[model samples]
Target: MIIELIVCFFATVSFGIIFSVPRNSLLLGGGIGSLAWAIYRLLPEYGVTSIFATSIASITAAMLAHFLARKYRIPATAFTIPGIIPLVPGSKAYYTMLAFVEGDYIGGLELGIVTMLQAGAIAAGIVFALAVFSFGKGIGHRYEGGR
Candidate 1:
């Protein structure tokens, strides 16, 4: 578990550098990625499916991105893009392509579908988080208008 978190942190930080995220924000981005990956890794022990786990992790990461963005006055993408890297289904996508290359149409099809579903889950999670944040922002605005 400790090893996993360490690896995730470095992986996210590397991605943040590659994406040109601000130097001051790299640690926060790495922390977010590690937290999301921790939740993802622990959920499977409790019988949570990969798709649902990925969705949950993405939501958590997105929410953190919003919080960090507001606090640091930077765009949320600085944190989000790198934060979600640890949860990406890279191995599954790789296997899907490998299956196709090996002429296993049925296996490739199955893996492709699963990969698509996982990607959709990640998108749904981000959308859900954004919706919640927007709703809260709207309410805050309404209250401030009365002042």
Candidate 2:
């Protein structure tokens, strides 16, 4: 448990470095918590299905971060990208590139399709969350101009 927490902390710091997140600790802590939540879902009885779950969980965390940023007057992109990095389908992208480099055209094509699907899945999850949040915020609400 202690090791896992430490790993998550360092992973979060690495993400902060890679993404150029500001040194403020709250964003760093949020990244750690979000990543840890995804990794926690990556275990248990679900096995490989956990990857999909982690992707969805990261999207959810990104959405929550977006909301908090909006409510607290911070930059939205600052929270969204780092929060989602843990679940990015980077391995699949690398495999796709490797297949292409090895002259396995068919395998490369298949991997390309899989890579696009994974990207689409991640995008769909984020869009779904944003749509729901927007609907909840404005569905029946009146504007200051008087609806």
Task: Give the per-residue lDDT digits (tens) of candidate 1, residues 48-101.
Answer: 998889899999999999888989999888988888999888999999999999
Root-mean-square deviation per candidate? 3.5, 3.9
Model 1 gets an lDDT of: 0.91
TM-score of 2: 0.68
- In the predicted model 1, the residue pairs found to clash are none
Cα deviation of 53 in candidate 2 (Å)? 2.4
The lDDT of each candidate is: 0.91, 0.64
Q: What is the TM-score of each candidate against the true structure?
A: 0.90, 0.68
Clashing pairs in 2: none
* Worst 10 contiguous positions by lDDT, candidate 1: 137-146
RMSD of 2: 3.9
